[model samples]
Target: MSKSIELKKKAAEIRIRLMQMIHKAKAGHTGGSLSNTDILTVLYYHTMRHNPMEPKWNERDRFIASKGHSVESLWCILADLGYFPSSELDTFSQFGTRLIGHPNNKVDGIEMNTGALGHGLPISVGMALAAKRYDNDYRVFCLMGDGEQAEGSVWEAAMAGSHYKLDNLVGIIDRNGLQISGSTEDVMGLDPLDKKWEAFGWHVVSIDGNDIDALIETFDKVPSVEGKPTLIIANTVKGKGVSFAENAINWHHRVPSEEELALAVQELQAQIESLDSKEEPCHE
Candidate 1:
Protein backbone atom coordinates (compact mmCIF):
# COMPACT_ATOMS: atom_id res chain seq x y z
CA MET A 1 0.00 0.00 0.00
CA SER A 2 1.04 3.58 -0.52
CA LYS A 3 2.46 5.39 2.48
CA SER A 4 -0.41 7.86 2.43
CA ILE A 5 -2.97 5.09 2.34
CA GLU A 6 -1.18 3.23 5.10
CA LEU A 7 -1.07 6.33 7.27
CA LYS A 8 -4.72 7.02 6.64
CA LYS A 9 -5.55 3.44 7.62
CA LYS A 10 -3.49 3.71 10.75
CA ALA A 11 -5.17 6.96 11.71
CA ALA A 12 -8.59 5.43 11.26
CA GLU A 13 -7.68 2.36 13.26
CA ILE A 14 -6.32 4.58 16.03
CA ARG A 15 -9.52 6.61 16.20
CA ILE A 16 -11.53 3.42 16.39
CA ARG A 17 -9.31 2.03 19.11
CA LEU A 18 -9.49 5.27 21.08
CA MET A 19 -13.27 5.31 21.00
CA GLN A 20 -13.57 1.59 21.71
CA MET A 21 -11.14 1.53 24.58
CA ILE A 22 -12.64 4.58 26.25
CA HIS A 23 -16.13 3.28 25.78
CA LYS A 24 -15.24 -0.16 27.12
CA ALA A 25 -13.24 1.14 30.05
CA LYS A 26 -16.00 3.59 30.76
CA ALA A 27 -13.19 6.01 31.58
CA GLY A 28 -10.54 7.97 29.62
CA HIS A 29 -9.45 11.34 28.33
CA THR A 30 -11.35 11.09 25.08
CA GLY A 31 -10.93 14.65 23.89
CA GLY A 32 -7.20 14.94 24.37
CA SER A 33 -6.45 11.49 22.98
CA LEU A 34 -8.54 12.04 19.87
CA SER A 35 -7.08 15.48 19.35
CA ASN A 36 -3.51 14.20 19.17
CA THR A 37 -4.23 10.95 17.32
CA ASP A 38 -2.82 12.17 14.03
CA ILE A 39 0.43 13.34 15.58
CA LEU A 40 0.92 10.05 17.42
CA THR A 41 0.08 8.15 14.25
CA VAL A 42 2.71 10.03 12.31
CA LEU A 43 5.37 9.34 14.89
CA TYR A 44 4.79 5.67 15.67
CA TYR A 45 3.86 4.58 12.18
CA HIS A 46 6.06 6.79 9.99
CA THR A 47 8.67 8.84 11.83
CA MET A 48 10.05 7.32 14.99
CA ARG A 49 12.66 4.57 14.96
CA HIS A 50 11.81 1.74 17.32
CA ASN A 51 11.61 -2.03 17.37
CA PRO A 52 8.17 -3.41 18.08
CA MET A 53 9.45 -6.89 18.92
CA GLU A 54 12.24 -5.59 21.10
CA PRO A 55 10.47 -2.82 22.93
CA LYS A 56 13.53 -2.05 25.03
CA TRP A 57 15.93 -1.47 22.16
CA ASN A 58 18.48 1.04 23.42
CA GLU A 59 19.09 2.48 19.99
CA ARG A 60 15.38 2.92 19.29
CA ASP A 61 13.69 6.29 19.20
CA ARG A 62 11.83 7.18 22.40
CA PHE A 63 8.37 8.74 22.53
CA ILE A 64 7.17 10.25 25.77
CA ALA A 65 3.54 11.24 25.98
CA SER A 66 3.99 14.23 28.26
CA LYS A 67 0.28 14.82 28.53
CA GLY A 68 -0.31 11.41 30.00
CA HIS A 69 -4.07 11.61 30.03
CA SER A 70 -3.83 10.83 26.37
CA VAL A 71 -2.38 7.41 27.12
CA GLU A 72 -5.21 5.71 25.33
CA SER A 73 -4.09 7.27 22.06
CA LEU A 74 -0.52 6.19 22.65
CA TRP A 75 -1.62 2.70 23.58
CA CYS A 76 -3.63 2.38 20.41
CA ILE A 77 -0.67 3.42 18.28
CA LEU A 78 1.66 1.06 20.10
CA ALA A 79 -0.72 -1.82 19.59
CA ASP A 80 -1.17 -0.99 15.91
CA LEU A 81 2.58 -0.96 15.51
CA GLY A 82 2.75 -4.50 17.00
CA TYR A 83 4.21 -3.58 20.35
CA PHE A 84 1.40 -5.75 21.64
CA PRO A 85 -1.44 -7.66 20.13
CA SER A 86 -4.34 -5.48 19.06
CA SER A 87 -6.55 -7.78 21.13
CA GLU A 88 -4.91 -6.44 24.26
CA LEU A 89 -6.46 -3.08 23.55
CA ASP A 90 -9.82 -4.42 24.69
CA THR A 91 -8.44 -4.65 28.22
CA PHE A 92 -7.83 -0.90 28.50
CA SER A 93 -8.67 0.57 31.89
CA GLN A 94 -10.12 -2.67 33.12
CA PHE A 95 -9.05 -4.07 36.46
CA GLY A 96 -5.46 -5.38 36.25
CA THR A 97 -5.12 -4.35 32.64
CA ARG A 98 -1.70 -3.00 31.65
CA LEU A 99 -3.47 -0.54 29.46
CA ILE A 100 -4.27 1.83 32.28
CA GLY A 101 -5.67 5.31 32.02
CA HIS A 102 -2.09 6.53 31.89
CA PRO A 103 0.96 4.96 30.28
CA ASN A 104 3.05 2.56 32.31
CA ASN A 105 6.58 1.49 31.39
CA LYS A 106 5.72 -2.07 32.37
CA VAL A 107 3.70 -2.22 29.21
CA ASP A 108 5.53 -3.65 26.24
CA GLY A 109 6.29 -0.40 24.44
CA ILE A 110 5.62 2.29 27.04
CA GLU A 111 8.81 4.14 27.93
CA MET A 112 7.32 5.73 31.01
CA ASN A 113 4.30 5.83 33.26
CA THR A 114 3.03 9.38 33.03
CA GLY A 115 -0.21 11.09 33.99
CA ALA A 116 0.95 14.09 35.94
CA LEU A 117 1.38 17.10 33.68
CA GLY A 118 4.75 18.50 32.61
CA HIS A 119 6.76 15.39 33.42
CA GLY A 120 7.54 13.86 30.02
CA LEU A 121 9.96 16.54 28.80
CA PRO A 122 12.29 16.25 31.75
CA ILE A 123 12.39 12.51 31.29
CA SER A 124 12.90 12.97 27.57
CA VAL A 125 15.80 15.33 28.23
CA GLY A 126 17.40 12.74 30.44
CA MET A 127 16.93 10.13 27.75
CA ALA A 128 18.43 12.43 25.15
CA LEU A 129 21.32 13.25 27.46
CA ALA A 130 22.00 9.59 27.97
CA ALA A 131 21.90 8.92 24.25
CA LYS A 132 24.37 11.70 23.65
CA ARG A 133 26.67 10.53 26.41
CA TYR A 134 26.59 7.00 25.04
CA ASP A 135 27.11 8.25 21.49
CA ASN A 136 23.85 6.64 20.38
CA ASP A 137 21.84 7.65 17.34
CA TYR A 138 18.50 7.45 19.13
CA ARG A 139 16.21 10.50 19.26
CA VAL A 140 13.79 11.33 22.03
CA PHE A 141 10.40 12.64 21.01
CA CYS A 142 8.25 14.16 23.72
CA LEU A 143 4.59 15.06 23.21
CA MET A 144 3.04 17.63 25.53
CA GLY A 145 -0.33 19.27 25.82
CA ASP A 146 -0.71 23.01 25.39
CA GLY A 147 -2.18 23.37 28.86
CA GLU A 148 0.56 21.28 30.40
CA GLN A 149 2.92 24.11 29.52
CA ALA A 150 1.49 25.76 32.64
CA GLU A 151 3.83 23.54 34.59
CA GLY A 152 7.13 25.18 35.53
CA SER A 153 8.97 21.91 34.94
CA VAL A 154 8.37 22.21 31.21
CA TRP A 155 10.29 25.46 31.05
CA GLU A 156 12.97 24.05 33.31
CA ALA A 157 13.34 21.04 31.02
CA ALA A 158 13.34 23.36 28.04
CA MET A 159 16.23 25.29 29.55
CA ALA A 160 18.06 22.11 30.45
CA GLY A 161 17.66 20.71 26.94
CA SER A 162 19.13 23.85 25.41
CA HIS A 163 21.86 24.11 28.02
CA TYR A 164 22.88 20.53 27.38
CA LYS A 165 22.72 21.17 23.66
CA LEU A 166 20.36 18.17 23.37
CA ASP A 167 19.48 18.54 19.72
CA ASN A 168 18.57 14.85 19.81
CA LEU A 169 15.43 15.85 21.72
CA VAL A 170 12.28 16.81 19.83
CA GLY A 171 9.20 18.11 21.62
CA ILE A 172 5.79 18.17 19.98
CA ILE A 173 3.15 20.26 21.72
CA ASP A 174 -0.50 19.38 21.21
CA ARG A 175 -1.75 22.96 21.07
CA ASN A 176 -5.40 22.09 21.09
CA GLY A 177 -6.20 25.34 22.99
CA LEU A 178 -8.54 23.63 25.48
CA GLN A 179 -7.87 21.73 28.64
CA ILE A 180 -10.41 20.20 31.02
CA SER A 181 -11.79 23.63 31.84
CA GLY A 182 -12.23 26.30 29.17
CA SER A 183 -10.05 27.52 26.37
CA THR A 184 -6.34 27.59 27.21
CA GLU A 185 -6.37 31.31 26.44
CA ASP A 186 -9.16 31.79 29.00
CA VAL A 187 -7.60 29.46 31.54
CA MET A 188 -3.99 30.67 31.40
CA GLY A 189 -3.10 32.12 28.07
CA LEU A 190 -0.11 30.40 26.46
CA ASP A 191 -0.29 32.72 23.50
CA PRO A 192 3.10 33.56 22.07
CA LEU A 193 3.79 29.93 22.93
CA ASP A 194 6.30 29.63 20.11
CA LYS A 195 8.14 32.67 21.46
CA LYS A 196 8.25 31.20 24.96
CA TRP A 197 10.16 28.16 23.72
CA GLU A 198 12.36 30.30 21.49
CA ALA A 199 13.13 32.51 24.45
CA PHE A 200 14.27 29.40 26.29
CA GLY A 201 16.86 28.95 23.51
CA TRP A 202 15.09 26.13 21.65
CA HIS A 203 14.05 26.04 18.01
CA VAL A 204 10.29 26.18 17.40
CA VAL A 205 7.92 25.46 14.54
CA SER A 206 4.13 25.32 14.32
CA ILE A 207 1.83 23.22 12.14
CA ASP A 208 -1.71 21.91 11.90
CA GLY A 209 -1.60 18.87 14.16
CA ASN A 210 -4.16 16.85 12.19
CA ASP A 211 -2.62 17.31 8.78
CA ILE A 212 -0.57 14.22 7.90
CA ASP A 213 1.48 15.93 5.19
CA ALA A 214 2.42 18.78 7.51
CA LEU A 215 3.09 16.40 10.39
CA ILE A 216 5.40 14.26 8.24
CA GLU A 217 7.24 17.30 6.91
CA THR A 218 7.68 18.89 10.33
CA PHE A 219 8.95 15.72 12.01
CA ASP A 220 11.29 15.03 9.11
CA LYS A 221 12.76 18.47 9.83
CA VAL A 222 13.37 17.84 13.51
CA PRO A 223 16.40 18.82 15.52
CA SER A 224 15.67 22.15 13.82
CA VAL A 225 18.98 23.64 14.90
CA GLU A 226 22.39 22.15 15.51
CA GLY A 227 22.67 22.86 19.25
CA LYS A 228 19.11 23.11 20.48
CA PRO A 229 16.08 20.91 21.02
CA THR A 230 13.32 21.21 18.41
CA LEU A 231 9.75 21.94 19.44
CA ILE A 232 6.84 21.58 17.05
CA ILE A 233 3.92 23.62 18.32
CA ALA A 234 1.24 21.53 16.68
CA ASN A 235 -2.03 23.46 16.56
CA THR A 236 -4.86 21.00 17.13
CA VAL A 237 -8.45 20.87 18.32
CA LYS A 238 -9.77 18.92 21.25
CA GLY A 239 -11.88 15.93 20.16
CA LYS A 240 -10.65 16.10 16.59
CA GLY A 241 -12.15 13.84 13.85
CA VAL A 242 -15.44 13.37 15.61
CA SER A 243 -17.89 16.14 14.78
CA PHE A 244 -19.87 16.29 18.04
CA ALA A 245 -16.81 16.19 20.25
CA GLU A 246 -14.50 18.36 18.21
CA ASN A 247 -13.31 21.26 20.36
CA ALA A 248 -15.87 20.31 23.00
CA ILE A 249 -14.40 20.65 26.47
CA ASN A 250 -16.88 18.25 28.01
CA TRP A 251 -15.24 15.42 26.14
CA HIS A 252 -11.92 15.97 27.83
CA HIS A 253 -12.51 13.01 30.09
CA ARG A 254 -15.97 12.18 28.92
CA VAL A 255 -16.93 8.66 28.00
CA PRO A 256 -18.74 8.28 24.75
CA SER A 257 -22.11 6.56 24.97
CA GLU A 258 -23.05 3.73 22.64
CA GLU A 259 -24.73 6.14 20.29
CA GLU A 260 -21.76 8.46 20.33
CA LEU A 261 -19.34 5.61 19.60
CA ALA A 262 -21.36 4.71 16.51
CA LEU A 263 -21.13 8.26 15.29
CA ALA A 264 -17.40 8.46 15.87
CA VAL A 265 -16.78 5.23 13.99
CA GLN A 266 -18.92 6.46 11.11
CA GLU A 267 -16.95 9.68 10.92
CA LEU A 268 -13.65 7.77 10.84
CA GLN A 269 -14.95 5.59 8.05
CA ALA A 270 -15.78 8.70 6.09
CA GLN A 271 -12.26 9.97 6.56
CA ILE A 272 -10.83 6.68 5.27
CA GLU A 273 -13.08 6.91 2.20
CA SER A 274 -11.97 10.47 1.59
CA LEU A 275 -8.31 9.48 1.75
CA ASP A 276 -8.79 6.47 -0.47
CA SER A 277 -10.39 8.61 -3.16
CA LYS A 278 -7.52 11.08 -3.13
CA GLU A 279 -4.75 8.50 -2.96
CA GLU A 280 -2.58 8.26 -6.07
CA PRO A 281 -1.55 4.78 -7.17
CA CYS A 282 1.93 3.88 -5.94
CA HIS A 283 4.17 3.28 -8.98
CA GLU A 284 6.55 1.02 -7.16
Candidate 2:
Protein backbone atom coordinates (compact mmCIF):
# COMPACT_ATOMS: atom_id res chain seq x y z
CA MET A 1 0.00 0.00 0.00
CA SER A 2 1.05 3.58 -0.58
CA LYS A 3 2.45 5.37 2.46
CA SER A 4 -0.18 8.08 2.69
CA ILE A 5 -3.03 5.63 2.20
CA GLU A 6 -1.62 3.39 4.90
CA LEU A 7 -1.36 6.37 7.24
CA LYS A 8 -4.97 7.32 6.54
CA LYS A 9 -6.15 3.81 7.39
CA LYS A 10 -4.04 3.73 10.53
CA ALA A 11 -5.31 7.14 11.68
CA ALA A 12 -8.95 6.10 11.21
CA GLU A 13 -8.31 2.96 13.20
CA ILE A 14 -6.59 4.97 15.95
CA ARG A 15 -9.49 7.38 16.11
CA ILE A 16 -11.87 4.49 16.56
CA ARG A 17 -9.64 3.08 19.26
CA LEU A 18 -9.33 6.44 21.07
CA MET A 19 -13.06 7.04 20.88
CA GLN A 20 -13.66 3.60 22.28
CA MET A 21 -11.09 4.21 25.02
CA ILE A 22 -12.70 7.51 26.03
CA HIS A 23 -16.21 6.13 25.82
CA LYS A 24 -15.29 3.12 27.91
CA ALA A 25 -13.41 5.12 30.54
CA LYS A 26 -16.16 7.75 30.63
CA ALA A 27 -13.48 10.46 30.57
CA GLY A 28 -11.10 12.01 28.02
CA HIS A 29 -10.28 15.09 26.04
CA THR A 30 -12.19 13.81 23.06
CA GLY A 31 -12.25 16.67 20.60
CA GLY A 32 -8.54 17.55 20.76
CA SER A 33 -7.52 13.92 20.60
CA LEU A 34 -9.56 13.44 17.47
CA SER A 35 -8.16 16.60 15.93
CA ASN A 36 -4.54 15.58 16.49
CA THR A 37 -4.87 11.90 15.58
CA ASP A 38 -3.66 12.35 12.01
CA ILE A 39 -0.62 14.34 13.14
CA LEU A 40 0.33 11.68 15.68
CA THR A 41 -0.27 8.95 13.13
CA VAL A 42 2.09 10.52 10.63
CA LEU A 43 4.75 11.10 13.27
CA TYR A 44 4.68 7.74 15.02
CA TYR A 45 4.05 5.63 11.92
CA HIS A 46 5.80 7.56 9.18
CA THR A 47 8.03 10.40 10.32
CA MET A 48 9.83 9.78 13.61
CA ARG A 49 12.64 7.29 14.00
CA HIS A 50 12.27 5.07 17.04
CA ASN A 51 11.86 1.44 18.06
CA PRO A 52 9.00 0.14 20.15
CA MET A 53 11.35 -2.46 21.57
CA GLU A 54 13.72 0.24 22.77
CA PRO A 55 11.59 3.15 23.88
CA LYS A 56 14.56 4.80 25.54
CA TRP A 57 17.10 4.10 22.85
CA ASN A 58 19.70 6.83 22.92
CA GLU A 59 19.58 7.51 19.19
CA ARG A 60 15.82 7.40 18.80
CA ASP A 61 13.87 10.56 17.97
CA ARG A 62 11.93 12.19 20.84
CA PHE A 63 8.28 13.23 20.89
CA ILE A 64 6.87 15.53 23.55
CA ALA A 65 3.11 15.90 23.89
CA SER A 66 2.76 19.56 24.90
CA LYS A 67 -1.01 19.59 24.71
CA GLY A 68 -1.10 16.64 27.04
CA HIS A 69 -4.80 16.64 28.00
CA SER A 70 -5.60 15.17 24.62
CA VAL A 71 -3.48 12.15 25.33
CA GLU A 72 -6.00 9.46 24.45
CA SER A 73 -4.72 9.42 20.88
CA LEU A 74 -1.06 9.19 21.97
CA TRP A 75 -1.82 6.41 24.42
CA CYS A 76 -3.69 4.41 21.80
CA ILE A 77 -0.91 5.00 19.27
CA LEU A 78 1.80 3.99 21.73
CA ALA A 79 0.02 0.74 22.54
CA ASP A 80 -0.79 0.02 18.90
CA LEU A 81 2.92 0.50 18.12
CA GLY A 82 3.80 -2.05 20.84
CA TYR A 83 5.43 0.40 23.22
CA PHE A 84 3.11 -1.14 25.82
CA PRO A 85 0.41 -3.75 26.03
CA SER A 86 -2.75 -2.78 24.22
CA SER A 87 -4.74 -4.43 27.00
CA GLU A 88 -3.54 -1.71 29.35
CA LEU A 89 -5.89 0.67 27.57
CA ASP A 90 -8.68 -0.83 29.61
CA THR A 91 -7.14 0.71 32.74
CA PHE A 92 -7.03 4.19 31.31
CA SER A 93 -8.18 6.88 33.78
CA GLN A 94 -8.84 4.13 36.30
CA PHE A 95 -7.37 4.14 39.79
CA GLY A 96 -3.59 3.60 39.72
CA THR A 97 -3.30 3.29 35.96
CA ARG A 98 -0.11 4.59 34.35
CA LEU A 99 -2.35 5.86 31.61
CA ILE A 100 -3.75 8.95 33.26
CA GLY A 101 -5.49 11.97 31.76
CA HIS A 102 -2.07 13.40 30.88
CA PRO A 103 1.19 11.74 29.90
CA ASN A 104 3.39 10.20 32.53
CA ASN A 105 7.18 9.92 32.05
CA LYS A 106 6.97 6.47 33.62
CA VAL A 107 5.46 5.40 30.33
CA ASP A 108 8.13 3.80 28.16
CA GLY A 109 7.79 6.14 25.20
CA ILE A 110 7.21 9.39 27.05
CA GLU A 111 10.16 11.74 27.45
CA MET A 112 8.69 14.19 29.94
CA ASN A 113 5.55 14.37 32.07
CA THR A 114 3.33 17.03 30.54
CA GLY A 115 -0.21 18.41 30.84
CA ALA A 116 0.48 21.97 31.91
CA LEU A 117 0.53 24.20 28.86
CA GLY A 118 3.74 25.99 27.73
CA HIS A 119 6.21 23.59 29.28
CA GLY A 120 6.64 21.29 26.28
CA LEU A 121 8.43 23.66 23.95
CA PRO A 122 10.88 24.71 26.65
CA ILE A 123 11.67 21.12 27.50
CA SER A 124 11.95 20.30 23.83
CA VAL A 125 14.38 23.18 23.42
CA GLY A 126 16.52 21.73 26.18
CA MET A 127 16.48 18.33 24.48
CA ALA A 128 17.45 19.78 21.14
CA LEU A 129 20.18 21.87 22.74
CA ALA A 130 21.44 18.79 24.53
CA ALA A 131 21.61 17.05 21.19
CA LYS A 132 23.85 19.81 19.95
CA ARG A 133 25.96 19.93 23.08
CA TYR A 134 26.55 16.18 23.28
CA ASP A 135 26.68 15.79 19.51
CA ASN A 136 23.61 13.53 19.41
CA ASP A 137 21.66 13.61 16.18
CA TYR A 138 18.17 12.69 17.37
CA ARG A 139 15.50 15.29 16.66
CA VAL A 140 12.87 16.49 19.11
CA PHE A 141 9.25 16.91 18.03
CA CYS A 142 6.88 18.78 20.34
CA LEU A 143 3.12 18.96 19.74
CA MET A 144 1.43 21.99 21.31
CA GLY A 145 -2.15 23.18 21.33
CA ASP A 146 -3.03 26.47 19.65
CA GLY A 147 -4.61 27.66 22.85
CA GLU A 148 -1.33 27.02 24.58
CA GLN A 149 0.14 29.67 22.34
CA ALA A 150 -1.09 32.30 24.75
CA GLU A 151 1.44 31.15 27.29
CA GLY A 152 4.38 33.57 27.34
CA SER A 153 6.87 30.82 28.06
CA VAL A 154 6.28 29.34 24.62
CA TRP A 155 7.76 32.45 23.05
CA GLU A 156 10.72 32.31 25.40
CA ALA A 157 11.44 28.80 24.20
CA ALA A 158 10.83 29.91 20.65
CA MET A 159 13.50 32.56 21.02
CA ALA A 160 15.90 30.12 22.64
CA GLY A 161 15.33 27.60 19.84
CA SER A 162 16.17 30.19 17.22
CA HIS A 163 19.03 31.72 19.18
CA TYR A 164 20.62 28.33 19.66
CA LYS A 165 19.88 27.40 16.03
CA LEU A 166 18.24 24.14 17.00
CA ASP A 167 17.22 23.00 13.56
CA ASN A 168 16.72 19.49 14.89
CA LEU A 169 13.67 20.64 16.85
CA VAL A 170 10.20 20.69 15.30
CA GLY A 171 7.17 22.24 17.01
CA ILE A 172 3.66 21.50 15.80
CA ILE A 173 0.57 23.38 16.90
CA ASP A 174 -2.70 21.46 16.72
CA ARG A 175 -4.57 24.55 15.62
CA ASN A 176 -8.06 23.20 16.11
CA GLY A 177 -9.27 26.53 17.56
CA LEU A 178 -11.13 25.20 20.63
CA GLN A 179 -9.89 24.83 24.18
CA ILE A 180 -11.47 23.31 27.26
CA SER A 181 -13.49 26.45 28.03
CA GLY A 182 -14.22 27.70 24.51
CA SER A 183 -12.59 28.86 21.30
CA THR A 184 -8.99 30.07 21.78
CA GLU A 185 -9.83 33.48 20.37
CA ASP A 186 -12.69 33.85 22.82
CA VAL A 187 -10.22 33.32 25.62
CA MET A 188 -6.96 34.59 24.10
CA GLY A 189 -6.44 35.96 20.64
CA LEU A 190 -3.68 34.19 18.68
CA ASP A 191 -4.32 35.41 15.19
CA PRO A 192 -1.07 36.15 13.37
CA LEU A 193 0.27 33.23 15.36
CA ASP A 194 2.53 32.00 12.57
CA LYS A 195 3.90 35.48 12.12
CA LYS A 196 4.64 35.62 15.81
CA TRP A 197 6.71 32.47 15.55
CA GLU A 198 8.54 33.84 12.54
CA ALA A 199 9.30 36.97 14.47
CA PHE A 200 10.77 34.72 17.14
CA GLY A 201 13.28 33.52 14.49
CA TRP A 202 11.79 30.12 13.69
CA HIS A 203 10.79 28.83 10.28
CA VAL A 204 7.00 28.47 10.13
CA VAL A 205 4.81 26.41 7.83
CA SER A 206 1.02 26.12 7.88
CA ILE A 207 -1.01 23.28 6.41
CA ASP A 208 -4.24 21.36 6.76
CA GLY A 209 -3.48 19.33 9.88
CA ASN A 210 -6.12 16.70 9.19
CA ASP A 211 -4.93 15.78 5.71
CA ILE A 212 -2.89 12.60 5.75
CA ASP A 213 -1.06 13.44 2.56
CA ALA A 214 -0.32 16.96 3.66
CA LEU A 215 1.00 15.78 7.01
CA ILE A 216 3.31 13.24 5.39
CA GLU A 217 4.67 15.75 2.93
CA THR A 218 5.14 18.49 5.49
CA PHE A 219 6.93 16.32 8.02
CA ASP A 220 9.22 14.88 5.34
CA LYS A 221 10.59 18.36 4.64
CA VAL A 222 11.47 19.32 8.16
CA PRO A 223 13.89 22.13 8.99
CA SER A 224 13.07 23.25 5.44
CA VAL A 225 15.37 26.17 6.15
CA GLU A 226 18.70 25.49 7.74
CA GLY A 227 19.70 27.08 11.06
CA LYS A 228 16.18 27.57 12.46
CA PRO A 229 13.63 25.59 14.43
CA THR A 230 10.62 24.50 12.37
CA LEU A 231 7.11 25.35 13.49
CA ILE A 232 4.17 23.65 11.79
CA ILE A 233 0.84 25.36 12.32
CA ALA A 234 -1.38 22.41 11.64
CA ASN A 235 -4.85 23.77 10.97
CA THR A 236 -7.25 21.13 12.18
CA VAL A 237 -10.90 20.62 13.12
CA LYS A 238 -11.85 19.92 16.69
CA GLY A 239 -13.55 16.52 16.80
CA LYS A 240 -12.56 15.54 13.31
CA GLY A 241 -13.96 12.34 11.67
CA VAL A 242 -17.11 12.03 13.81
CA SER A 243 -20.06 13.83 12.23
CA PHE A 244 -21.53 15.24 15.41
CA ALA A 245 -18.33 16.38 17.08
CA GLU A 246 -16.31 18.05 14.35
CA ASN A 247 -15.48 21.62 15.34
CA ALA A 248 -17.99 21.51 18.20
CA ILE A 249 -16.61 23.21 21.33
CA ASN A 250 -18.62 21.17 23.84
CA TRP A 251 -16.92 18.00 22.62
CA HIS A 252 -13.52 19.21 23.82
CA HIS A 253 -13.66 17.25 27.04
CA ARG A 254 -17.09 15.73 26.57
CA VAL A 255 -17.13 11.98 26.46
CA PRO A 256 -19.40 10.57 23.82
CA SER A 257 -22.73 9.19 24.90
CA GLU A 258 -23.33 5.50 24.25
CA GLU A 259 -25.39 6.43 21.21
CA GLU A 260 -22.84 8.96 20.05
CA LEU A 261 -20.08 6.41 20.46
CA ALA A 262 -21.97 3.92 18.29
CA LEU A 263 -22.43 6.45 15.53
CA ALA A 264 -18.80 7.53 15.68
CA VAL A 265 -17.61 3.96 15.35
CA GLN A 266 -19.83 3.43 12.36
CA GLU A 267 -18.47 6.51 10.67
CA LEU A 268 -14.81 5.74 11.37
CA GLN A 269 -15.28 2.13 10.32
CA ALA A 270 -16.62 3.37 7.01
CA GLN A 271 -13.51 5.49 6.62
CA ILE A 272 -11.33 2.45 7.29
CA GLU A 273 -13.19 0.43 4.70
CA SER A 274 -12.92 3.24 2.18
CA LEU A 275 -9.16 3.50 2.61
CA ASP A 276 -8.87 -0.28 2.47
CA SER A 277 -10.71 -0.38 -0.84
CA LYS A 278 -8.25 2.02 -2.37
CA GLU A 279 -5.45 -0.46 -1.71
CA GLU A 280 -7.11 -3.23 -3.73
CA PRO A 281 -6.18 -3.75 -7.36
CA CYS A 282 -8.64 -2.48 -9.94
CA HIS A 283 -10.51 -5.13 -11.88
CA GLU A 284 -10.98 -4.21 -15.50
Candidate 2 backbone collisions, by pair: none
Full-model lDDT, candidate 2 = 0.94
lDDT per residue (tens digit) for residues 1-284 in model 2 = 99888899899999999999999899999999999999999999999999999888999999999999999999999999998999999999999999999999999999989999999999999999999999999999999999999899998999999999999999999999988888899999998998889999989999999999999899999867889999999999999999899989899899898999999999999998998888899989
Ten-residue region with minimum lDDT total, candidate 1: 1-10
- By lDDT, the best candidate is 2
TM-score, prediction 1: 0.96
Question: Compared with the true structure, what per-residue lDDT tens digits does model 1 show for residues 1-284?
Answer: 67757786788878987898899889999999988999988898888888988888888999888899888888888887788888998999888888888889888888888889989999999999999998998999999998999999999999999999999999999999998888999999998989989999888998999888889888888767899999999998889889999988899999999999999999999888887777757688
How far off is residue 36 in model 1, in Å?
0.7
| TM-score to native of every candidate shown | 0.96, 0.99
Task: Tell me the whole-model lDDT of each prediction, alpha carbons only.
Answer: 0.89, 0.94
Q: Which stretches of candidate 1 lie over 4 Å from their true place?
A: 280-284
Each model's Cα RMSD: 2.0, 0.8
